[model samples]
Target: MKSYSTRAMALIASAGLLAVAACSAGSGTSSGSSPGADQSLSIGLVAEPASLDFTTTDGAAIPQALLGNVYNGLVKQDDSGKIGPDLAKSWTVSPDRKTYTFELVDNAKFTNGAAFTAADAVFSINRVKTAWTTSLKAAMDVVAEAKAVSPTQLQVTLTKPSNGWLFRMTTRVGAMFSQTGVDKLATEPVGTGPYKLGTWKRGDSIVLQRNDAYWGSKPFFNQVTLKYFKDPTALNNALLTGTINVVGTVQAPEALSQFTNNDKYQVIEGTTNGEVVLSFNNSRPVFKDVAVRQAIRQAIDHKALLDTCFAGRGKLIGSMVPPTDPWYEDLTSVAPFDLAKAKAALASAGVAGTALRLRLPTLPYATSCGQVVKSQLEQAGLKVTIDQLEFPAAWLTSVFKNADYDMSIIGHVEPRDLGAVFNAKYYTRYDDPTLQALLASADAGDEAAQTEDMKKAARRLSEQAAADWLFLLPNLMVADKNVTGLPANAITESFDLSRLARS
Candidate 1:
């Protein structure tokens, strides 16, 4: 079983990326204390140019926080986790399940003022089949071809059955970019979303105002500001001074301390199932054996991840399916820490005490997971070497796209649907045919059939160790008390911020 656990790296990192980008968010915010809630809103976030453009990592380069503001997909998911209509009003799947038809809404318009239609949807998917999609294969693999049947009707052809194809369409890659925007967007992007584009200062700041002519919900605030910060402390300072409105997954043990006496502030912390785990590119030589993978899993103390890195505010995970999601199989959550068993597994794989050097990107998720994991592996009898780079990218270049790492650490989110993580990684060298088959079966069935299929896939993934599913925890979203209408979506946070009833 090749462990595909999406430890916090992939999960919170995107939220973290928003925070990284928050440092300079206040750089030139009209230079004053925000006057009134009705006109302007400054939200804090951190983002690295995960991709300068789409060619970087998958077809979608921007983090959810940024993309949530600037891009509109066929459907929109709110921060509350509701999947609602966006560019497309409704869609129907063919009985054979190879085809998916969608009806586009009439009023949708791109930032450039071009009409959005079924043709653009087809263009987004089909264009990815070409050179524009190199980094996006894993995310785009299940999609075969996309085409339009009419000006407002679009169809998608898949290589196999896919129940969650529509959801994937709303992801970053799923956002529709103007045909004209595609050429100029490498530097200046144009999209159909709630907020219009503002000046994008690479290392410093980003500012946007509500698209008053928005097609959907009207944003409560007029101006939306995003800044980038390299230091977590500096970003927190913005929050302290009230220069920023919110911070996602920022590490501060005393975060409560900062907000204690402030009536205008609020803190939201809960248990989320997002976990961070290591993945061995099964296509690579050293990680070819299940025993070696098991040994690595056994070596780390997930509880320590919670204590040291999370400041005692997280859950330890032992499976690939997060508990917060319904499709998650209960059994994967049962692994107990057994150092002896882990060592035995390593010996079984003939990897005990062997030189196992790998590249790990240290960012977001639990702080110090890479460093802590390295120390644990050494104690478990593996010769460890560390090549630290930025999060997500290091793993992307080394494992998924280029296959350069010995072992990689990543945080994976078990999206609302379980099949997402599995389909992206299964048999892409992880080699568990059962897991792939279940996901394929899901695509072929109805909603109920799909859920059951995903549950079954969850079981297979737990058993196959496609990766450690890890723990289910709550997402932390801190905002000004004035920001109203925060929806209680399950842990699966949607990006639809327009519906938020801010004061």
Candidate 2:
């Protein structure tokens, strides 16, 4: 097995080969001698997990931040985004790529002490396939059926060749659960991971204890605590005051200097899949014109927007695909910053003086980003009024589902998939068969071919100005200097406990 450092270097070489391509880890913790044994570690979480039942929640970063510790999928991802054997000791794919056969790890036992087997694998896969709104259901829906060949063997048959089967397995949605364990899911969740749920106080914190009977290497700490906080400043203060041992994914980039400039902490930083976009509702007449959309894209300065919003924490992205993705194309050239050109294009589209209504939800970065966008659009001779919603649910219901607004600024954070813009069923208001065909072609073929196809599709999207590409959100992890072994790649889920040790 390759170390994370080696695998990460390979990942960067394969993904970012452009002249401006460079990868560096975020700084939160300091470089010093390791500390003595610490029995426990506490993390300040931005929000509580949506649901303890992994099958129900959307499995976004917040949900997976907690669920990742409590669940074990058939396979697991290493710190560097490579898939490794977990409950399933090994797996072989059929030549056609439609069937996958997995060999179970015989000694693997669920937290409830039930022996994990092929039946559990069949049940878990089918559960997600039938579940209506699972985050990974779209990907798993291709599974024709999952059956147990024997107590120690399982086979999954897919309707077509799915490139995401193995990648999806590394997520919590693919986590295996025993029948008895799932029965108590609402109150107590059980899995084969290193940690078991110890206690839960709704809206407060979740406590996890080491599963001593774990089949793999155990965690160094006896217990782990996840503390929830809605405020980034509060979370940073906690880390500084020693109320929490670590802080993962702090939303406010302004607070980063508090840890980055300090010598007592270590910070691991890198780009994540959360590529922010200035989405235009294509159904609206004002934005329906491609000229207007392209004008809007060129109007806002990517550098100024990212600098004002995240204090220059992340890099400018071209399409929905972030720079961290292997298929990422530096299409920033497609939409260059030209306020005069933007103004001319808007006037040509006959919507130059219209005050477009921009509706935004109050996420950590939304308000500031929206404000900057408003200023830039106004400068480009496009009148704009900003309406900020207090809650994300309201924004989703009104702006996304109902199409109640003209435009909005938001970040789409799902990793390794661009279904948000490519899939017709998703929230994008565009209805183009040509673009859909290009996306399908991009998703098919061998690895190298897929990379070329992805670049083609990304370029097409950029040329058409699919969505106003803003910037790729960066992943930052801050911890006490004594802590170690944080993953250096873009994955937010696999923050493995076994990797951490206070020196």
Candidate 3:
């Protein structure tokens, strides 16, 4: 079999190529050495996530990547954030750019010997679009519908052409699930990927064995194990002690520095091209006007925030679309970083003296962005409030369903599809002719036309101040020196853990 590394190289040559894309690994103990233990790979995660289901939460980036051990997508993004073939051996887009017809690879099957077919992809997309309880693809509302036309063919129709529709389908939210497996064995998952779930010990660790049946290239070493840690310190300690072979989620810069200084570990940085943004309820009377948006932008110094909270490891961003992306725009015409301009803009809009109260969602991201913005607003002479949130009660109701904040920070990770993140940040109109024309030209219609529309959209996103684009962040992955092929942007899920091996 071709090594996973070679496969990744070929896949990258095929996708995620244009990306140039870092955060620090939180502190941890190194287990094993550079190159990792021989028999099994042990990994760590930052949170005890709510679900292992792909459609639920994107599974917190770390575990979901390993969970490829048990789940697979028909198509997935390569490191460059470009779509690459997965279960689908090949595909064709309609000339109109609205229909995507996929042809499944023959002889593909899950661990349980169940055949992998195009029907699974259709079922997965439908589940995502129709399921009300899922949090995975809230940003992806572009799919008009998806269905299976034949055993090996699936079709996805969009309301209109959306340049980002393809990328969105390759995400975790779009991971293909076994129809029978999902109906009966969701708790006991099965996937046609590189690895298979070997054992699940509740509240403990999950073990994954290499899937010899996988049709594509496979990982080098045999198995992978993921351990959960509420606090990163414990996860790091395990790495240092050699109890755990690798740690996946690195949220602390100091931790990354510590790991880098040690000769025992290798740090992998990739462009997640995701952001931690401070969003506004545009429907809210105060945030509706562009001047107030300018004031909020003026009050918060993104550079200062990055230095203070992220340990100076972050990209200062100003819009929903990442500046590095081809579709990105500087919108030099939008509000500048000038504090006086912010204040003057607010005064002209007649919202400067008004006290604006907002709540900040803290659990998702590393810091309380609300508190940070609150201080900035106060400095700008506007009274501000930062209400900290916690738990099932505080999270959904207060943030999404209720729009319960004057301002709040939201986490958008693995947004390979700009539409997946952009919609949540802006463009919520249920229907519009102008947006329709732009999106039609975007989807699969024409690259030049789509690029032009996307450029216009990016500028409009900034001019409208859709969301105060706070920080464009890169995910920092710290791997033991023993680990190889787990490089950044290697996969859509990023860093397939199946290949890591200890010395």
Candidate 4:
């Protein structure tokens, strides 16, 4: 399996020439790639993008899958994790590592037929600091200024040397958008990508059509539709009946088994950068006690979660970063499962028999894991009430943004970007000046120093019992046997409908 960073690199790489090379005529053979007929596809999305505004969107899966196809960034990363050119065909960095100058691709144009230039890049990146995306401001906090040096040239100055700047550029927050289309982006996004948004039937489905005027190599499929199914059973049924060519997310152990065993389907399983966690809202009265947090961490079994929740498909994670990631630390034994230790901690915290609210979104894995955790914590003398929620809107408005729950079980899906959640200012509410400082050092240092500091930060978070770090989430794509060009790994670009085909 490729590491999470490697997967992210490929995801960003697809925003550049790599995607064109992947589906071009000489690359391979598939029904969609054939010269004669115009191919089409229907995909079942686990959920819709929270909003069409990619710059401020928070849902991990849909944004990662949709951004690369709908928007373009200045730089991209290759399979080997080397930085490459994307919308900005070339760039030069100053010795101080604070200023970067990029040469934009002149041929690129937005879906509205407006030309793309350095001015658009400047406006788009600078938009991060605006009130529209306040939650994501920290990610680009180091960027002091961005300006258009010329029609096709752009310059960006940073507050400090940032090792992760290029990685940050790979995210949707850094994607360039036409300044004129800013008003319409929230409802209908316009970008210089392979496909144009066709129709979005609010809760039902989204349709995308190939952009005939696209600057890069043409995608194989003429049209692609992403359907949404609220129930996992209904989603599975859609796939089984061939109503949809692909089922985007499938984490249930039984569903995984059924899909893998069924010869009629092509089941692809691999590790995503997503880390499933029993996240805590530290500001809450119950979680404010360190002993209570430690007790909950000790009560749950990481290995058993892998076995029960995922059927041993994912890896045991000690922290937010997965083991496959470079900055990961071997802290799996940091909080071992011990019922006695858990009981003692709960007793010390004076919450041994107190009922704690455990909020869970509608995801199958989360609901299933919540049941297991409820039982384990109950056995350890900790009471838990599972509050299941409707996805996207409910979770986004309450649990994620408002920090309305005491504890919740969900996966943080972006890889090499865990820094976004480390601060108390953004929902998690576990604040430590030492951690923030260490992360700052990591962000400014060289690759080795960054890795070391990140590891230290991860250790600090785990030692504080900030959250119960659970198993790494796996990406499982179940498709019809005839479908082709399904992404090899779970990355931002893995679900690019443009690459798929009916073989």
Candidate 5:
């Protein structure tokens, strides 16, 4: 979970204007094409990227739209979360596991017309440490050196053996950038992928056009439009009225019946790494007490909360690790919902009537879940207040950067983001030396030891009640019947457009 900065623009209220624009832009019809051979596609999404550049902007929306669509990485994670070759055709690890050598693809070229070579790979890897401003850049800090041995070969050596380094390369940190195109990354991007940025209408939509000179297999659609919607009903309506082909992120799960019952549409229900967390600001005096934190965790019934807030569409993951991770465990028994235990813990801490704030980002899940949390905690004899802050901007400022809230809720969507959220200086302000040591040990170990250590770290976080793991967000998507190659699970930040096709 990288720090979501205030840079992401707010969603403007002009649904009617967008409806007209989308109908013309996303008709999925191309000149001289037959009925079933649509050359364009439109997808409804909740969030829009504030900027095209993920190097400076800290949010998932940017990469979700660009990564694997407009940009290609050295490596990429598939639907199952396995690392596979992208620009780099193949790779090998040294016996020591500290160095990685890559075999580059010669035919690939950046959208800017620069050849994708080892030098560009080295430059991209090195730029992350020297120039990237987002917290995700730290993943590249392990690189001791990235050198190009030849036009088709690249080598990267780490300071130490890291099991997670190569996997992290599948993320935005690994996106290959052209040296000549670094000037306008925020407004214009250059990458070697199947699609190129076509048009971006702020507060409306971003259209990606197919690169006719693409190196690999041709994408199914010539154009893909990511249409933005502030309200979930609008997103659903966009699909119903034939304005869009797919709803990429289903915001309102309770209204899913409208799509599920229709034969013309297909509803995809899968899992994501998004853990809708009930975050407690551990730095605050009232939450600093372990008993208070545990009391809150014990008070809320996770199942009921999930049922009420999310329409019981997600998983009850008791820790930061989602089931997709290798080290996942069902730790729900750790702090089961118990009203008596919650009251007893609050009384023991002498903070029964202490006033606490549950500040929430204006995300659908947080707003819906905040009510349940307030009701449950109030029953446990704790005074609670709910504050709805505008997402990305106000929420990131007051809750994430300033640490001005007692409690908050936001979905941590980045893959395998346990280390980022629990970081000592992160918004949660949970600084446990033992947990840090465990994470460090996990990163520097072999595959077997890494999984064991990560499991231990997750267990430690759950037992200590670092934060209440509310529920893992379900990857609920609604697409037209003709849309093929839809990913069942969302294991990465990118809503990869390369695999989608029309039947």
Candidate 6:
């Protein structure tokens, strides 16, 4: 659920105390009235959600649009990537770290008029184990039991001590659902957050209306519109022409100069956990050979790819571990770009000139980056074919679900998504017991041990060329000067409309 198309546009925060980088020019005021005068605002984004039901859907788009704005979890991750209380007013963990007791807020109510209670928490957690179909549901497998000790108190016991279980709760897997509103999740979503579904025009936009009866402080905007655009030009045009007040994700990084030269817009540049990966299907006969994988990794010039595809606006991380993760390491040197070494590796594997498919989602970054990957691989004597699949629908079904791809390009935007994407059963089909063991050890170890072990796991993964990490996508946004509370770092899947306010 943390993975999305590169254009999905959600960024993440770092662990501990992470500083957010943001800058703007001109007066921070839109072409509207003063503070609290404009009660509605329109924002532009790419890659709209396939559906509203995240329990059955897999991509990050749903959670990016709905998580913090519509649904409230037991715990929420702040912009700093620190976990804090949300619906659960407070919580206590046992000394053993296997049990968690939560005291729920007494005043929270769902959009459907159902009062939120500990029983709803029980139902939601159990539903993840029983009915959720997404791969992200595996995060809840560690839970031994979820019980409502009282109407406003909930308890959950994990099967073992896990350093990541509580953190994962800050994701979509921890979203609380109402029993009464379960029937129409795909069409209508009801939650205890500050906003409710207003109107959704499929392929165009979704409007979220403020919940007058929300338990938390009311958000500044009475209504927020999330307008979708497949074409990056249209996305920018919407902001330039006043169709939207904000370009939530500047899809065309090269076009930023148009806004940067103008005094009406503020450009925010920050960091995100979104790693644009060149993933290989390990189950495929060609990729099953580690030598071939290594050759592929060594063939591409990451610096050149980043420059051509993203206007050199991102970082070359060389591994799945983004800088925000505590276990991060700069492993780009592990597989230096060497055409001669690449050819030698392919020849040793008896796969030189082997034909391979490079399927790509229609997301802006993938389509752009795939060309460079193909041209580079071909230079190393591999025959590469490019196939563009419609994003979220065709790409999610063919590549992400069925593993019907030799290789693909995607942006894994979820914070700390190493364990999920590399799972044996995941679409990558990367079944390595040693890697799995290291990840397990990292999760069960103490904070210091976890960091050390995770570093080893990441190094092992990169050394083996498990996947080619293209680069870390930068968080870039262009909004009207008046839009305040814009997060400098995208630390979670949610765009968090509640955080936005007019200056």
Model 4 error, position 202 (Å): 1.5
Superposed model 2: Cα runs more than 4 Å off: 1-38, 183-187, 390-392, 399-404
lDDT string for model 6 (1-503, tens) is 23234111121111001112111222223344333534899988777778898888767777777888899999987645778899998999999999999999999999999999999999999999998887778889999999999999999999999998999898888999999999999989999998899999998999999988999977878899988888888888999999999887766789999999999999988877788888899998888888888889999999999999889997899898878788899999999999999999898889998998999877777788899999999999999999998877888788878889999888877778776777568878888888889989988989999999999999999998989999987878899987887777766777777767786
The most accurate candidate by lDDT is 6
lDDT by residue for model 3 over 187-291, one digit each (tens)? 566678778777766556767777888876566657777675545567678888888766665655556777888998877665444556566776678876766
Q: On a 0 to 100 scale, what is the lDDT of residue 474 in model 6?
A: 80
Q: Note each model's CA RMSD in angstroms.
A: 5.8, 6.2, 7.2, 4.7, 5.3, 4.0
lDDT of 5 by residue, 162-264 (tens): 9889988887789999999899998888999989999899889999999878998777788999998867788889999999999877878899999889999
| Alpha carbon lDDT of each predicted model | 0.57, 0.67, 0.56, 0.70, 0.79, 0.81
Candidate 4 per-residue lDDT over residues 118-202, each given as its tens digit: 9999888877777345355566778999999998999999988998777778666677788888787767888888788888788
Ranking by TM-score: 6, 5, 4, 2, 1, 3
Candidate 1 residue 454 C-alpha distance from true site, Å:
2.7
Q: What does candidate 2's lDDT look like per residue over 1-503, in tens digits?
A: 00000011111101111101112232122344332245899977553543565454332433344445668788866544577787888999999989999998888888889988899888888877675354346667778989999999999998878676777677555788886677657568888887888998876788888888888766777788877676667888999999999876666777788888999998877656666667778777776678888999999899989889878987787886766568887888999999999999988878878988888755556667889999999999988999986333355456555668888766655455555344445445777677667656655567787777777777877888867867876666788987766545455344455556676
Could you tell me the TM-score of candidate 1?
0.82
Looking at candidate 3, what is the lDDT of residue 303?
76
- Least well predicted 10-residue stretch by lDDT in candidate 6: 10-19
lDDT against true structure, model 6: 0.81
The candidate that achieves the highest TM-score relative to the unseen native structure: 6
